[model samples]
Target: MMPLDNRRLLRSIVKLTEKPDVRAFELALLATLTEIVSAKTIRLCKIHESAKPPSQKVVVDVRVSDEEPLGDDASLPTLLIDDAAFLECLAKEEKVVASIGLGPGVRIVHPVKAESKMVGFLVIECEADIPRDQELVSIMLGFYKNYVSLLTHTQRDKLTGLLNGTTFDDKLLKIITAQRVGKMRASDGKGLYYLAMLDIDHFKAVNDKFGHLYGDEVLLLFGRVMVDTFRDSDLLFRVGGEEFVVVLRDVDLAQAVAILDRFRLAIERYPFPQIGKLTTSIGATIISGEDLPASIIDRADKALYYGKNNGRNQLWIYENLIAEGKLKVAKDDSSVELF
Candidate 1:
């Protein structure tokens, strides 16, 4: 049978990590290599420099059935090489590194590097009897280097280069779940969290008058604003269309309002190309423990509607409805307009 081709596989690896999920990208890389070399097992590891014992090494083990040829069971070399020796060789500042036949199988190691520094490593291996193909190794190593380069491009926003909308949502949900379960480190203080929804005032009008291209420019500008206004710890998602949501963990009603107010005024004061008198409306609410993600969003949307109605370019805290005597608990969806 013809052996795997390195040049073509390197190109494929370049395309793979361009995907949103890096883990998925790595898995695909191993799977492709497995086909070429007829190997058995692939284990990718991210060894952190500062981690303690078990916590330091984050390992992703991908196993293909032995019935399958060239799965994770191939005879690849393992890196029983000392940590210091491995780190020292990697200090040569190479992106792709490999070792063969130390453990039960032959193995390949690729460093995940961003901005010229090694962040982690990817390792793939196979059982003892499997012959390690030199051509395949060359191909896999080069492919891995290209994959790391693609990861840098794929994980960021096309414009602002913050995490893209979909990525942000995935990361946000993970953070929320982690914090809720105490898997994450707690912040200095605590209370009901808050979600603020912000919409650019007269956004459609700008698009209509200035053209869709400029409207995109406006959205990108607004994203920059959000990045500047919120803390690094805060989570923001461009939910859809012209709407963005900010989740502030451990924030109470009053703090939520103040933060939203600043965002509102920032939009109002900022100037843009071809668009004058820019402004935004904000709706915010303290998220309760009983609330689901949708419920929290709905409450914020209701408050946003109130802001738009009262006058655009303002902030409204949902909890203020009861205090102002303008709202009552409703049996149906009467309290807030969904759209």
Candidate 2:
């Protein structure tokens, strides 16, 4: 293959940096690199979280033509992660890190660092050894790192590194809205939906017991558990301290109850450290056409209050209260529960 024309490559790199997204930048760079150097595949791995002492590992994004599947290791070859020798060479060699004749093909691993930090890695695979002189590769990678950082911020919770509360809220709304719109024609039911609010049984206990640092850990861990337990379509939100909300779209009372039961059981089974065995009180409501988000939330809150007053670690549906006359027919100060 003809050597990559350095001047033209620089111009192309400038154009590629104009892409607005990390994936787009990766694809463009991979394509450009393939055209210039005749490489088989290009992968960009970006690592977001690392273990203590900083692993400096990155997870790659792969883009390839119809050659091979880019394979499993394309994104991030862990040989790059735990391998101190390979990394040291890349940092000091000022030359391409290559593996020739020993593997399926030549593996050229290049580190993409920004602001003196190893932000990600770019791996180029080809049939032969690749030379260094990576000015275009460096330029393209700089843009990619910035773009990935932005994408990470947009997708992650600023406090907990989970999906942001707003992002979850949006997703919940979408799923609920779709279910409501689609269920209009279902045979078993129409216009039935569910939503629930969850509040830590006594999150204040954590703050008092272990201080706010541990309290923060509890909240973060709580968010992680919620995300893990719920369906990807189910919306989970940390709307406030010790409070979360989930929308159960296209669900009847039984289904909604079952879903909440599962989450409640999961929480009850999982013992939280420092906080000990923790439980949550959940209030859920089925939505009607007359219901707005605020009203739906109010119903859930009422159910939550019922659970807290009667007992914690249980799912309380609004209909049960209405049937038992525990809740007022209309808003009035005089009808409030004495308990």
How many angstroms is residue 280 displaced in model 2 relative to the true structure, after the best TM-score fit? 0.7
Instruction: Point out the worst 10-residue segment of candidate 2 by lDDT.
Output: 62-71
Q: CA lDDT of each candidate?
A: 0.61, 0.65
Clashing pairs in 2: 44-60, 44-61, 45-59, 45-60, 46-59
Worst lDDT run of 10 residues, candidate 1, spans 62-71
Q: Write the per-residue lDDT of candidate 1 for residues 120-237, one digit (tens) a residue.
A: 5545454533335545555565656666567746655666545566765565455455445543322433444677888888889998999989998998888888877775335566
**Steric collisions counted per model:** 28, 5
Model 1: per-residue Cα lDDT at residue 265: 79
The TM-score measured for candidate 1 stands at: 0.54
Q: Where in model 2 is the C-alpha error above 4 Å?
A: 1-155, 172-187, 190-193, 288-290, 331-339
TM-score of the candidate numbered 2?
0.53
Top candidate, metric TM-score: 1
- Judged by whole-model lDDT over C-alpha atoms, candidate 1 comes out at 0.61
* Candidate 2 lDDT over residue span 12-108, tens digit each: 7787767654456667777777667656766665444334233454343444211111244434235344655346545663335566555677666
